[model samples]
Target: MPLALNTLKRPGPLSKGGMRITALGGLGEVGRNMTVFEHAGKLMIVDCGVLFPEEHQPGIDVILPDFTSIRDRLDDIECIVLTHGHEDHIGGVPYLLKERADIPVIGSELTLAFITAKLKEHRITPTTIQVEAGDRRSVGPFDLEFVAVNHSIPDGLAVAIRTKAGTVLHTGDFKMDQFPLDDRITDLRAFARLGEEGVDLFMTDSTNAEVPGFTISERDLTPAIDKVFTTSPRRIIVSSFASHVHRIQQVLDAAHANGRKVAFVGRSMVRNMGIARDLGYLNIPKGLVVDFRKIQSMPEHKITLVCTGSQGEPMAALARMANGDHQIRVGEGDTVLLASSLIPGNETAIYGIINKLTDLGANIVHKGNAKVHVSGHASAGELVYCYNIVRPKNVMPVHGESKHLHANAELARRTGVPEDRIMVVADGVTVDLVKGRAKVSGKVEAGLVYVDGQTIGAATEDTLAERRLLSGGGVVTVVALLDPKTNQPVEPLEFLTKGFVHDDRTFAGAEAQVNKALKRAKDDKIDDIGALEEIIVDAVSSTLRRTYRREPVVMAVVVDA
Candidate 1:
């Protein structure tokens, strides 16, 4: 169970020969996955990633893991071990590299290629070390071994870190799909071998812990996808994550079988697919894939478009098309396949896109109505199997929300792990392992760092609150030209309102209240512009609350005339 938040305190210095583990993100939530491990005064990080902003976080491009706790210790970091190439698993690497550019980044070949491509966009040339499944390397005091894991994306890995303190096997977002499109399966044999060597703490993905039974194989979707291609009367548009090479491969095959040329839309979809194809992860038949621009000229039944925005990102191709803002128009008889699951917190946006596309006469097919997507994380049955196979002394669930973590902890409990031995922690909660026992140590500063356009960490909670207030209640600006001697209004108070109301006359009561407050200030011989501005703000705020029953952002500007 998770420790009570009120009881958590700052952890003291690490004991000699003990390992400290702290999650900067990816606990109590789904994305921004990062964990810091300390042994022998050296730190090793795994999976620095980003969280997509929710609807409430206006103007935020992405949310990064707070690096404040380790900002001063960047030089002590040995390397960042990445498990996969998904955006949520590797998106924040470039931002972290900006702090220390020379930190060695270790991952599989495809993982390294994806990060390299992403870092190149940020103009930071990273120092990367490529390693694959079954590869072992010693960095600082940590002995790391990578194990192959099947996920939605190709080349996913699970890393086992061994040190004098203990061994921690972290399953980085995996599922036991016996038959994957790439023919790669999770290596349970390696897991059994590691179990024989004694795993002190097993940190596993908790994404699908709430889900019962094993996840269906990716191959099961092939029949459904082929059916979509065969039955669709017009152009077929399939939307999924850019890094989902397996899903894209299936789409390409389906399109080719149906005599339709595929075209990739969106910049990320084009770029990542090109990299995957070049690296032999994605197979494209000759003359099967065509350019998006060229696909426009093809007959509707002979063309297929694959794009991003399965989660309904406003800027992605699918969302733009749904809004009728893109070059590709969604008309009657067009089939739109959202070949991805609805990520939590994105339901409203996705449904909004679906509504828009439906209004445009497009036929929508999603996981809710069809078998177009399957999760990449292991479910309850798989988790139970892994727990029994590894037989770790302790278990800590990672990469999920609060319920998922607890559900995963229960799975461990059912597999004979003591309830007290399971650690369900949140971001910033510290855990220490010594002599093969893991316990919650303390807490640190783990908060959200938002990226807004060119600015990073500049957008704070208060800023988002103000944005929400403005977006919901609107803004009212009151400019008062006051007399220099008496602090009385030299001209009638000018009021400007936005998002609050359509007419300026709605602020007539607020103007009157401001004038009355200014008169009282003048009677008190208050001449300071700052003091008068405060009085004006207070009066307008109170009046708006009384009259309009709304509290908009009230901006008071006082100038001496």
Candidate 2:
């Protein structure tokens, strides 16, 4: 069972020879994955990433893990260990680097390449140490070992942190795909060796804990993709994550077999693929890939466009095509393949895009209708296998929501790991491992830091609430010019509204009510413009609520004449 939130207290100082673990993000949520490990007065971070904004978080570009707990200890960080190159696993590195740019970053070649390219876009050159699976390094007081893991993207890894206190094996998003396209499998031999070495705390990915059986291999998607290519008569447009190298490779193979030239549409898709190709992770046939501009001249049947926006992001190329706002427009007889899973909270947007594309006379193919995508995380059966193999003293599930965490914890329990040995907790919850025993210690500051445009950490919950009010209830502004001496209106009160009501005349009675309230305030000797403005706001709000049963954003501006 997870630790109770009410019982959580501020973490006390670390005891001698004890190690502290705190997650800044990626608990009870799916993104912004970060965790801080502290031992011997030093810290080592694992996976600093970003969470894409949901519909409720309007105008937000991305949500980052709050760095309040570590902002003061930036110099104490030895390095950041990245597991993969997915946005949810590496997107926030640039923001974190802006605080202190010299921190060393460690990852596989492709992972380093992705972050390096991303950091270059931010105009910050990062100090990176490239290491592959089986490489071990000792930084500060932490002994780190990287193990190969099979995920949606190539060059993924799972890291083992060995220290004087204990050993923690963090399985960054992974699955047991026996027949991966690249012929690389999850290294269970290394995991068994780590288990023999006695892993004290196992932090495993819990994203697919509720799912049953093993995840299907990437090679299994070949037939479905081939079918899509064979049946589609006109232009075929495939959408997927920019970081999914295996998926893109499969699409390339399918397009090649069907004798169609492929063009990558979105800037991110083009850039990331170029990086993957340069790193030898993506194998492209010569003359099979064409420029997007050149595809316009090719026959629709011979052209295949692979782009981003499988999640229905409005600004992505696929969504723009659905909205008829992109140069590569979808029309009759076109086949649109959404080759990605629907991320939670993105169902509405995805369905809306599907509807729009269907209305445009395009045949839609998705996971529901075809086997075009598979998860990158281990399922329940695989988790059980991992637990029985590793046989750790304690377990802490990461990279999932509350139910997923609980489900993963349950799997551990059934695998003979004592129920009390499982620590299921949310973000910021601290755990301490000492003498081979791990338990919840306390909590820290792990709030969502939002990014809006070029500003970071400026968009707060109150700002989102105000935006929701404006978007849902509209806004009503009451401008009152009051006498400087008596706080009486020097001129008739003016009401300006946007998205509040269709007709300004609808507020005629509201004007009378505000005037009466102002007169009463004046008769009561209320000379302060601020006080009078409150009176006007209360009167207007009451009138609107009583008449229309609606509560809009009522603003009163008081001016001294």
Candidate 3:
């Protein structure tokens, strides 16, 4: 969706003591879609979510928005209103709940079911209230109305948060699918009713704004996936996001139609879909689902495996199967259907998975080759449809990168909204709305807090940057004994390199550069431990670049003897 980020127009001021909307995350990026609504000192947080890390964010398992904006004012928060159960929308709930367990969470019944399962992992039992579209809840100064929105995940809502400042409609990731899979189309009637009442500010999802025409409905994927089940005479494995219960529902239906027994492979796929089935969101025939271990006993043509790792996550079930390391056998006469959108930046790994499957003589079915996947987000045509329906005074795009946001703003302008009425901003920047006008007021700390294993907020920006450097160019550690008198190394440096040096010649060459750096440090009479280490790092880096054209992370660990 990143076509361009051309600067548009800035916004003017709102009235005094107006409402402040700050996106702690989900402004400039795809994931971590959290926003704070402040009115008269009371706060309402919408969708505290998380962003999954890419290659650049090394060692980070997940990234949560910095809660510095609300950390000190935890008591000011009323309740967190969730839109859907997708990880990017609901993943950070447990992290937020860890701060204030008393804060109530409201979402659709299926959405709450997913949250409950996620929170159980952290030993947290949240104060949750289930509601459907048309359910109204007054939390402090804000009166919130949850309107159903058709997303990839079922039970998604577009919240109409009303305050004294005005009414703001937040369209959490949505699409205009007239024939939705579950028949729960985005409540356009409710949106039209709210639009008639006058929507002051509209925060819409801009994920697919750059794509022309409307997004294909979830219903569109059924025939394609059913074709895979009907045509394949071997075991069929479908890979997709576990949270896409609608897709899984279709997969189960297809298996039943083809007389195939279903088997869930990934931990999250099993846990989440099981929760979905129990909550009546997903329906399966009696004895339709068999344990993955029991699949061996069944005929290859009678088995259907649904799994996670559609993005080619290394340890995910699909990736493991592609590597032939999985317990489930996928070889000749097997079919692998990639029934999920190929996320940006995951092409290399995804292709690697496809190559492995093809090499193993399995049939590969994907969105590129077949109409097996459709985006959950609205495209340009659909965004225009929403804009025409809910004519707000001011329009701001959220849930995408800078270009996506800018593209959405232009789309709003084409809908007769003036350039000045369109606001395009990034995370941490606050938008103050009052009396049907909006403007950038101030900023907050919306930096990422990376989750590495069980360590949250322990890794800093510099630490991650170093990790990225190490990942690409590798890391070199020089351990030597330093003389306390001169802060000079008294012995030969021990060079330990990882992902850096290839042969003994490279290590031997680096050793000479290290010795020269030590000698220079001693001659300079530098005694400060920190400063001396910096010199070694600089010298070794220069050598690595000059000789090998590598910019590796060089560590100097000179122990005082």
Candidate 4:
């Protein structure tokens, strides 16, 4: 067993001490999820996920959890456990492995295969331990067991972690599906068994807790897709999360039954399909799958293209097709069915694509008034069922926004859990369980980290705010050359503004304000350059706010040459 986590090795003794739980992300909001469980100085992290960018955030695809708190103590990390293969839950694995590639990753066979494919995409593969439902394994001082749970995707699981303090059940993203397509359902009996063993804490998924009823099973999506395939006369296009291999299989079956050949596009869809087929998780008919390069030659009525970009991701195949940037453009007579609902905060981008596709003369189908997309999270009844099965001493809700957390808390209380036993934690807050009671002990430096192109570091809320400001307000720079000989201004101050305004627009008023500030400062003989810089920045900022009601970042350059 590993003694201490490498990510926590150098940090000073924690204030709470003993076994503590820190939610890196997914506490206050949905996505970019990570949770740290530290006991006896041994740390094990679960589900390092990434969040989808909001509408205001242009060009950014994902937001990952900051790992700085755990970076230095990776040596003591026993293992990295995964809940499923969804982007929000598993997207950060590559980034985490890039930092420390030696850490062992444990998950279901399908989950491990998916992670491996993702790692290979980044060219950084790590050691994987595949643990199925009912399998028990020990990592460091923690005893881990995988309990099967049904969700939109196959192989979704809730992890049962037994530590020295007590047994904690980390319910990964899950829904209680009675009529799931797969044979493996959430083993309520097993969860009840754990309850009998006396679980100290239960961390559950709150993504769909606020919804009134139980979520529709993944099988419910088939009839919707089947009707579209059976009725559409032209080529059909279906887009969804690539990790939903079962959904893809259902689409394939529907298309084949309707006498249409299916082609998988987008790099992610192709890669994941390959892995699913290889692992015997997905079975694709020999002639059903074809290269998109040969798509033009096939009859439009006989073709069904299943691609990515259901979230309106910029580089995804569907986005490229909608934007007319793809090699095979979306043309007339194509029936594009948006089988996925737009995630909250991505409505503008998704609608933009919808408009583009419609403008190109393709008929569009959506969930605007019909059941096209189904959530993979449990509702109140399902949550109650899981609670009744687990019956932990304490309840903690993870993997959702504040509203979901509040709902989950209420559900736990209504289900007979004590009011004092339920704890609501925000991101970065650590909860300590001492003698079977849980309370917030302290806070950790946890936030969002943007993994853009090649850079990986902390990109907190402030940074994202700055990005939004820069995009909207633009930037301004003022350069003044102060003559050291006479300590006076040599010439008219050079002012430059890019992205602040249009080419023809005149900022003469703003420029005059800066000049006036510089002249006033020079007359006073203000030798402190830093103070002068601040004054000029304030002047420009205040001017912009008055004129445009906007605040753009101002950089005042004082060069004494």
Cα lDDT computed for each candidate against the true fold: 0.93, 0.93, 0.86, 0.81
User: For residues 523-551, could you state the per-residue lDDT of candidate 2 as single tens digits?
Assistant: 88887778887898899989988988878
Q: Which stretches of candidate 4 lie over 4 Å from their true place?
A: 1-18, 458-463, 475-497, 500-505, 527-537, 548-561
**How well does each candidate superpose onto the true structure, as a TM-score?**
0.98, 0.98, 0.92, 0.90
> Residue 101 of candidate 4: its Cα lDDT?
90
* Candidate numbers, best TM-score first, in rank order: 1, 2, 3, 4
Which pairs clash (backbone N, Cα, C closer than 3 Å) in model 3? Answer: none
Single out the weakest 10-residue window by summed lDDT for candidate 4.
1-10
Q: What is the alpha-carbon lDDT of model 1 when measured against the actual structure?
A: 0.93
- Selected candidate, larger lDDT, 2 vs 3: 2
Give the Cα error of residue 209 in candidate 4, in Å. Answer: 0.8
Q: How close is candidate 2 to the true structure, as a TM-score?
A: 0.98
| Candidate 4 lDDT tens digits, 1-561 | 111222332234544435788889998787888899998878998988899877665446588887888889988888889988888888999988888898899888888888888999889878999888889999988989888888777888889888768889988988777888776677888889999999999999998888887888777777888888877778898888888877788888898788888788888898888888898888888787878778658888888999899988888888999989887678787888887756666788899999999999888888885576778888988999888877889999898888889899999998898887888867877778777887666676776676656666545567778888888878888887877654445776666776877443345666678767767776887768897788778877888789778787788888886
How big is the positional error of residue 548 in model 2, measured in Å on the Cα after superposition?
0.9
Residue 89, model 3: Cα distance from true site in angstroms: 0.5
Return the TM-score for candidate 1, rounded to 2 decimals: 0.98
Which parts of model 3 have CA positions greater than 4 angstroms off? 1-17, 479-492, 502-520, 528-533, 557-561
